[model samples]
Each structure stands twice: as C-alpha cells, then as structure tokens.
Target: MTCSPPAAPGPPEPPEDAAVTTETVTEPVSTPRERRGWYFYDWAASAYNTTVTTVFLGPYLTSIAEKAAGCAEEGQTCADLHPLGIPVAPGSFFAYALSLSVFAQVLVLPIVGAYADRSWHKKRLLAWLTAFGAGTTLAMLFVTGDRYLLGGALLVVSNILFGAAETVYYSYLPQISDPDERDAVSSRGWAIGYLGGGLLLLFNVIAVLAGDSLGWSTAEIARWSIVSAGAWWAVFAVYAIRPLRDRPPVETSRSRSVFYAFNQLGRTLRELGSLRLTLFFLIAYLVYNDGIQTVITLSATYATEELKLEQTALVPTILMIQFLAFGGALLLGAVARRIGAWKAVLASLVLWAVVLVAAYFVPARAPLQFVALGAAIGLVLGGSQALSRSLFSQLIPAGKEAEYYGIYQISDRGTSWLGPLLFGLAYQLTDSYRISIVSLIVFFVVGFFLLLAVPMRRAILAAGNEPPRLL
Candidate 1:
C-alpha cells in the first residue's frame, strides 16, 4: 500500500520583475479554537440523537400514534392503526416514520452536500439546517394523543434537517484536520461528542424521573424533553458559529447554481468507476451501516415490545451505552494506531456479528441481554463510525471534500431501509423478535468481506488525481 504525500506548501514566489501581483495566502494550520468549534457541532447535534432519535421521542410518538388510532366511542381500547401508508399495526407507525425519515435523508443529503461545496457559506448552510431540525423537534411538543399525522410530519421535517446537517458536518472534517493528524482529531471529536451527548442524556433521564415524583403528566414530561432538545441544540451551536471560518467559493461559469451542483454530482458519479477502492468501500459501508443504524434505531423499541422492559429502565440503559461508547471510541482509536483504520473497522464488524448472534439466544433474559448488548454495541459503535469518517476524509480529493461527502451521505442514508425492512419481515413472518436480531448479522459479514478487498491507500491516490467535482 502506497501512501500519498501530505499537502504541499504554496508555490515559490516570483522574482521582483514579475508583471502580476500574487494573491495573499493563509497558513493551512487548523487552530485549537477552530477544532473545538467543529467538535461542538457534534456536541450540539447529538442531543437530537440521544433525546429524540435514540431514546425518548420515538417511543412517545409511537404511543401517541397508537392512542390516536384508538376508538373514540369505546373509551376503553381499540385496534392499532398504522399511519404514513405503512401496514396497520401497533408498532408499525414508528416503522413508517423511520422509513420515511431514511427515505428523505437519502434524497436530500447528497444534493445539499454538493451545493454546499460549490458555495462559500458551508457553515451558514449548516446553521440553517441545524435550526430547521431544532425547530421541528420543538414542534413535537404540540402533538397530543391521536395526533399521529402531526407527529409524523414533525419527525419527517426534523429528520431531513438532521441528515442534511450531518452531511455538512462530515465534509468539514478534511478542512479542519491536517492529513497527519486526521485520525487523532477525528477520534477526539467522537470522544467529546459521546461525552457531551451522554451527559445531556443523563440530565434528561433525571428530568423524566423527577417529573414523575413531581406529579407531572406523561404529556408534560414528553413536552419538556422535546423543548429541551431544541434548547440544547441552539445553545451549543453558538460555539460552532464563533470560531469556524468558511472557505471562499471557487469561481464557476455563470450557469452554476444549486441546480448546477446536481450536474456536477452527475459528473462525479460517472467518474466513480476510476476510483475502484472507494466504490467498493461505499458498497461495503452501505451494507454494514444499515445494520448499525437499525440497531440504534430499533433497540429501544425492541426492549419495550419484546422484553417487556419499562420506559424508565430502558432510558437509563441507553444512557449507559452512550457513556460507555466514549471509552469504546477512544480505545478503537488506539486500535487504529496499532493496526490500520480499515483493519480496526473490520475487527469492529466481526465483533458486531458476534454480538448479533449473542442477541439471538439471550432475548428472554432482560437484564443480562441489556448489559451484554449495550456493552458490545458501545464497544464498536463509535470506533466504526468515527474511523469511517476519518478514512473517507482521506479518500476524497483535495478540493471536493463536500461534494464527495455528499455522495458518502447518500450511501449512509440510502440503504438504511433494508435492515428495518428485514427486521419487520422477520417479525411478521415468525412472530418472533429473535429472528429479527439474527438477520442483521449478514450485513456485517458481507460488508466485512467487501471491505477486505478494497485497497485504501490506492483509492486515496486515485481520488487525489481526479479533478474536483461537486458530487
């Protein structure tokens, strides 16, 4: 494997007789303040992941959708109904919401990513998307019992903004870290993110418990959680805005606009055949990440529905995983130093496969399953995600980081439905949750083998040689 040279300094200056004046240049170093600002975006955005996506909002929305579908005349009980054109069932509303969110993410993230790259205001674009997501999350507070449509609409909007912000965030990685320090910087960002997200989640958990003691209704607690998520997002985003500098826009033809970004994206897709290893890595990532996302999205639901775990117990368990993931991400960074980032990711995939198999056998034993699964997931989740970000940052060409990362976001969000579809099928077919857990292992195994075949260093070199394109 051949490594590419680090980015060179500016060209030598012309002699005094030179006719044209040269443009002023800035040093390439990423300052500590700027790096901290970048990491704070992760901290700000992760509150949504912890409080809304992973823990509180999903279950609460599902419950509301179900109750709203309940009979009005009976005032006792009613059959479950599915909204969003998904199949009618008690849990199906959440499934529909997840699928819709994933679908929108697949469509919107790449386009926005490409557009952001062509424009000078990447951070400004990110701020807008963040605010959109935060506002939508706060809007969820108004959804009461039987307000399934309202809740679903809010989720769709929030999730779309969330996914778009992520594309912007990942694209910024290359700008913020020198080639030599990429992995270390990326790892530190993930570590800080986990710590921030976990700490906030701990506070939310306490708030929920305290609300119960204070005789707050379920709706009141849910509303408080939703409002707090938005506040958290807005507060932390201030740091990101203060220190990060935006790259100046590259000059283009008069025809270029947001729509033209898609044309550039088309060119990038056409050229993908020249970057064989990157293409392969994308395929592999799509498969395995599907499983990873499914696990994260569905774990709470599985615990509540299958294991009969209470919301109170499940929330704390999820919080524990968040804290544990901080250590896990740091350890994996060390592992990456010992081995390569690619190999460390492979090891994590292998661990995931093993953990999924274990999940199959231990579903009935709630306590042991909770502890075991949480630890196993915590061990691999941060490492796999953070390292993948660093590795991909290396592969993108020097000037087109945002454009390529947009394509990367497509892969991240596009095939997200497969795992959930499979899980739903397994549950429907066998009426058994165990089979659903077992089915995800295939994604990890297949992705691992595919990853083994890709040559990372070669891909980086090829990407370096390519002309910058928005996609």
Candidate 2:
C-alpha cells in the first residue's frame, strides 16, 4: 500500500531536460496486456510474503539469534543477545525486525509515492525496487550460524524494499484499469498472488518434510527455501513489468529539495483535511483493517497457546487459508461486480464480525472446529482486502494515486498496532485469549458504521476522480 494522491494544485511544469525518459500518454489507458502484467507483479511479490515473512523467517531468525545467545535450539530459553550493546531477546528477534521494517516503511513510503507520481517511468522504479528487494532476500542464503544481527538487518531491509515496491505496484491500478473494473483487476491480482505464494509455500513444505530423507540439515533446507523465494521473485517480476505502460506525470516539475518527499508528504496530509469523505474512509479502513491484520498475526498464537495445537497442524491450516483465499478474492470480486465494491466490503466486515464471535466460542483442543474457523477466515480474508484496495482507489485524487497510497500504507499491510494493543490489554486483564480475540468487534462495528456514513460517489467526485458505474 502507499499514500493517497493529493487533489491540491501541482507545481508548474519543469524544463524539457528535466522530463523523465519514457513514452508518455495524454491520460492512462487500460489494456489487457498491461493488466496481465500488473497481475503478475502481485504474483511475484506475494512469494516474499508467504515464504520469507510468513513461513521461514521467524523460526530461522530465532534459531540464528539463539545460536548467538549460546543456546542449542531455536526455541530454547537463553540470555538476551546484546547487539551493539543493546539487549534483545532471541525469541523476539523476528518481531523486533518486523517492527523496525514497518517503521522504515512508514517514514519512506510516502516519499517514494511522491517521487513515483512525479516520474513518468513508474514501472522502471518498480522494477528497480523489486530487484533490490529480491537481492536482499537472496542474501539471506548466507545468513547462517550465529549471524543473528546480519539476519535481522537483512529482514528489515528486504521488508522495507518489499513495501516500497508494493507501493509503486499498487499505484498502477488506477492507471491500468477503469474505475468500475478496478474491483475485478485488484481481485484478480490478489487471487493470482495467493496462488503464487501458496504454490511456493507448498513446494517448501514438501521440501521440509523430505529434508531428513534427503540427508539435509534443517538449517540448510531453510536457507535454500528462503533463497528460492528470492529467485522466484526476480524471475517472475521480469514478466510482470514487461507489458506495463508509462503514463505522463500530472505535474512535470521536479523538486530539488533534499526534503521534497517529506515536504510533499506534509502537504498531502494537509490536503487530506479538506477531502472529508476520503479521510473518513481512511479512518474506517485503518480501524477495521487493524482488527483484520491482528487476527492474521495472532491466529497462530491462538492455535498454539489456547487451542494447544501442534506446529505441524498449524502449517496445514496456513496452507488452507492461502489456497482458499485465492477463490475468496474472486468470489468477492464477483459480488462487487453484482453490487458495488463499497457494499461488498461492508458485507465482508459483517462477516468478519461474525468470525470473531465464532472464534470466541470455539472449543479448546478442537482441531476440526479450528480447521472450520480457518476456512471461514480464508473465505473472507482476500475478498475484504481486495475490495478495500479497489474501493480506496476510487476515493483518492487521480494524479496523486501513489502519494495517497503511501499514506494508505501507513495502516495497510499489518502495520497498525491499535488492534493488537487492545488484544494484549484484554489478555493481560483476564488471561483469556478468547475474550481478547472477540474484543476486536469494536473495530468492525465502528468501521462498519463509519463506512455506512461515506457517500461514495460524492467522495470520488470530491477527489477529482470519476466515479465508478456501480458506485
């Protein structure tokens, strides 16, 4: 995700020499070839999400950190490793790395959007970021033994690069598709991404299962698995960017200030003050999405600590969600085409509320019930998110899509902490994970009402964007 585009006036045109070196069009035109390319980028990027972040990195990094702390096993309790004279727990290494990466994204992504919006070669920028990000992931292959600090640094850098590339990639949606077709396009991208990520993860799972038989150490297998994802990302991205077209910058002037993106980001936030509907939608999205992400981030913990499920069982559940989510994105996209994106998102929120309630009542040590709950989550997960992106695309100013999406990224991609904070507080008070899990209803209920109040067409027009036919 990225920042929302600004509707405020742009700077005057710069000299021809300052112009970006790319073919320019009068306005963005949607084409089937370009759309397919855009979809493949998602497919490429999701490998990082599924393989590195979701499946491999946490345990691998923790194992490295444990080694650094003189522990024999990954999950062993040991003294904190003091890197650069700062104490850090081995178990928390991955979490701390994730936090640091998200912090970097929050600071940099808006500026990335600002520069991207001003450039004619946005696809080129996307390709460069993808390469750099993949390179960082590839470097993970060398993060062996007790190099926990190096592993943590790579994770942070790769994650930031991942977010930056994603921000640029998302900025393409408005330029590549019509307003009404956005739901379908975004949904297809997400579905393809899920498939790609799931396929790689499935392969890795098989590899992990056969590691002992193949006479490979778990560490070696993990290293190869991690690097394979990077290879997959780099290889697939070439095809993704090949067909994407270049669109002319709305504002041709290049800001010379070293603080241009920062300055522009400040201006963008100020501009959002007047775009009430867009702001309202952003607020609603932030609140509810925090809940959705918290559910995703904490689900494994719930299954382990509360349900007492084994790690082996959780792997299959995660795979189930990944594969099913592909269908879910398409399913909700069809619903969006029938009704409207906004309404479809609203309906998904209702379903989210119900899912939380069901989670609260699920029996402890019930694997079948837990599997059923996972299925429910998988069905609603991709649909809600895909529709949210499509719906927000309609609410931002046309020329500033990347910029606004940078702002949007501040809360998107599991960055927001409010929901998790609330969950933690609830658990701390009552020692009941179930109560904490269900407590997220505040976000959904409030978001649903906030969304209800948004006048979609009015917001689109106010943002200087054309309203979708259904909206």
- Predicted model with the maximum TM-score: 1
Candidate 1: stretches off by over 4 Å: 1-28, 71-86, 250-256, 411-415, 465-471
lDDT of 2 by residue, 228-318 (tens): 8899999999999999876766664557342776788888889999998999999999889878877775676567657767545665777
Q: lDDT tens string, model 1, 1-471?
A: 011111123234433211121111112457889899888888887788777777776677767766776643324564657454545555556656667777776667777877887665778888898888888888887888678788878877887788788888887787776665677778878877888888888887887777778898755676677778878887898777668877643323355477787787787677676777778888888888888878887777677667777767777888888888888888998888777788899999999998888777765537756877888888888888888888888777555677777667654522266787788777766767778878889999898998888877777777763211111
Residue 238's lDDT within candidate 1 is 78
Q: List candidate 2 stretches off by more than 4 Å.
A: 1-28, 63-91, 217-220, 256-258, 301-311, 357-366, 414-442
Residue 28 of candidate 1: its Cα lDDT?
Answer: 44
Whole-model lDDT, model 2: 0.80
lDDT of 1: 0.73
Report the Cα RMSD per candidate.
6.2, 5.3
Which lDDT values do the candidates have, in the order given?
0.73, 0.80
Q: After superposition, how far is residue 456 of candidate 1 from its true place, in Å?
A: 1.1
